[model samples]
Target: MLEGLMLGLQSIVEPQHFLVLLIGVFVGFIGGALPGVSGTMLIIIVLPITYGMEPISAFILLTTIYVACVFSGMITAILFRTPGTPESVATVFDGYPMTQQGKAGQALGIAVLSSATGGMVGAIFLIFLAPVLATFALQFSAPEYFALAILGLTVVATLSGGDLIRGVIGVTIGLFIATIGMDPLSGIPRFTFESAPLLSGVDFIPILAGLFAVSEVLRRSRDDHSIKDTFQKFKTKIFDFPIIKKILTTLTRSSLLGSAIGVLPGVGATTAAMLSYSEAVRWSKHPEKFGKGAPEGIAAPESANNSAAVSAMVPLLSLGLPGGATTAVILGAFVMHGLQPGPMLFTNEPQLVYTIIISMLVINLLMIIFAKPFITIFSKIMNIPYSVMGPVILLLCVIGTFAVRNSMFDVWIMLLFGIIGFYFDRIKFPLATIILGVVLGPIAEEEFRRGLLMAGGDLSIFINRPISATLLGFALLALTLPLLKKVFSKKTQPPPVSG
Candidate 1:
């Protein structure tokens, strides 16, 4: 292992490999700062270009891009309330609120710091715990996955603010939308209404773009006030040691949570972020401050998503299983180079694997250095008049949405979702809850059905497995805890001052 690490370090320092890493990081940063442009899309675009490159260099470039892009998404999410990727959706909850309060620098600074910390932690786990975590992840079957998804769905309580009913309504709406495509088991459509595009279900990128980006545009358009007048001066210094110290606990907790969740197949950074955000709120001393420019808010999701991005590579490296869409693309890149990524890869190409892992650590440190100047530039964006910025954001939304599938159908879907998002925002509904439903509903349904099939339609399987039972028990507790607390508090409180 030491010899492999030395060799990997040597390879990354080579002039050509170093240059490729820098280029990848730069391109990834730009891609992730643009709304609707996800790391998966960027990898797909750059995959062909890597065909003529050396295998090690290609791997380094792609992996660096993967790590950098996950962190970069928080930049736009903080500055403009627009998440560059689905993983950064949680960042928008607190990041944009901070920006609105003239604390864009602090928010961006925390995001960069937390992301770097999380990435480093994940790299450590990938280096030392990959095999162990992969073995543990192997224990998860359909029943376990279904239970985990249910546990994740319980986060709706945290996102609902004070409106649990409305949150459930939002989640139901999202679940319905997720069901629009073909049935996972049967070869039949449910709610496509014979539309060819709906057969593929709602594309997440366009929906995210519309919900956050286009909706913001419409909301701003309704206001007669000029954006420039309300804009605060951009802060130049991006680091705040005091704030960093303040949220170290949240950062550490989120990083661990993200790395753990990332090892599970099909559960991506998005879920990690949402779960981390909910956990942060749960453990916080002042949970009411979350989603209102709380430092812990930015720290939690940014850390989790970045850590998840790195640890998601564990399953692929150890078991040849892609943990998420970005890693799925990297898996294709592996096959393109005539190299497999399972346990055998370790023996066959030990140095190569170590090089990729080491490069990720270096890439994350470089992101921190590179982001400082960029944060200054991004913070200035808030000063632009909404009249000018709104149209540009809309154009980017249209172009980015169209670019996702190269279909005009997606553009229309984005527009429709933008309208829906605007209406939801006006009605005080929780958009995050709906997004969570859309993202997790399909996974839960498919896993539940698969578990039933495995059990020959017996419901006992869920509770029969210890892991699944524990997770479901946690979900049940999570669902009932708030009400239980409310009841208990009422019993303990003084009798309304005996009035």
Candidate 2:
């Protein structure tokens, strides 16, 4: 094990590999700072450029971007109400509120510090546990996978942001959108409207860009609100050891929970973030203060999401199964280099696998050092006029979506989803729920179908399996608790937090 660690360190410390790591960190920070963009999108966009590079080098570059992007996303979420990616959505609840209260620097500082710590902890967990965890993950057959996917989708409960109906509506719309392409089981098209491109279904990148980036652009254009630049006057230092210690103490359990969830296939960063946020709320001394500017709200989700992002690599690196869509894309990079990930990877190329793990740790540490100066710079972007910023964002959305598949159909999809997102926003629906549904619905359907087939069409299969049963029970709680609250609670308006 020590020999493997040494080789991994040596491989990534080279000038060429280190240069890619630097580039990746730089790109990732920018991507995360930009609302509507994410670490996963950044990786997918740049993947073609790495086609000719060696497997380890390319893996290091891509994973570095992924790691840094996850952390850097909190910059935008904290400074602005806009989340840089879905993973950073929870950051905005307390982070933007902190900014509004003239503590932008402090919020940014905590997010950066906590995210870096969580990422490193998760990396360490991955290094020690990936092999053993991968063996356990192999036990997850279709039934367990489906149950886990349902459990992930249940995150809408917390993500709905105090509007349960709107959250349900958002999820329903997303699931409706997910059904727009050809039927997966049947050969016939479902909602393609006879367009050939829809046969493969709505692509994830464009839908994500449209739902988040373009819609935000359009909505912000209608508003005459200006971002307050309180950070300029706020004298706050980034390094707060006491605050870091406190955050670590509060977030350790949540971070571990997120890492465990992330190791499961089909679950993604958003779920981990949402679940951790909910758990933090549950454990908070002031539960009612959650939607308000509670520091723990910022810390818990940021830590958990970053941890989840890193731990996701475990399944991808050890087992052949892709942990999520982003990891699935990473798998393509591996295949491009004539390499396959699985048990064989352990025996055949320990150095390569170990190098990727080591690179992740290095990239996470680098993000903290690199993010402080950039956070001040990013805070300025919020002050840009909405009118001028709107078109530029629209253009980015168009370009990013088009770049995904070089398809006009995707561009159209972006516009249509943009309209849908705008309507959802106007109706007070939770857009995050919709995005989660769109992302997870397919996986849930696929795994459920496979599980049923394996169980001879027995509906009891979900209850019969131990992991499946536990996950299903958890899913039921997620789905039902809000409804129970609605039915039993008093008819009083909740206190408004600083938005």
Largest lDDT belongs to which candidate? 1
- The regions of model 2 sitting more than 4 angstroms off are 1-11, 14-17, 34-66, 73-114, 162-169, 184-186, 225-356, 372-389, 455-462, 481-499
Error of 1 at 226 (Å): 5.7
Could you give candidate 2's per-residue lDDT for residues 184-224 as a string of tens digits? 88777888888789888887667766665677667877776
Pick by TM-score: which candidate is best?
Answer: 2
Q: lDDT of all the models against the reference? A: 0.80, 0.76
Query: Over the full model, what C-alpha lDDT does candidate 2 score relative to the true structure?
Result: 0.76
Ten contiguous residues with the weakest lDDT in model 2? 227-236
What lDDT is obtained when candidate 1 is compared to the true structure? 0.80
* Candidate 1, residue 29: how far the Cα is off, in Å: 6.4
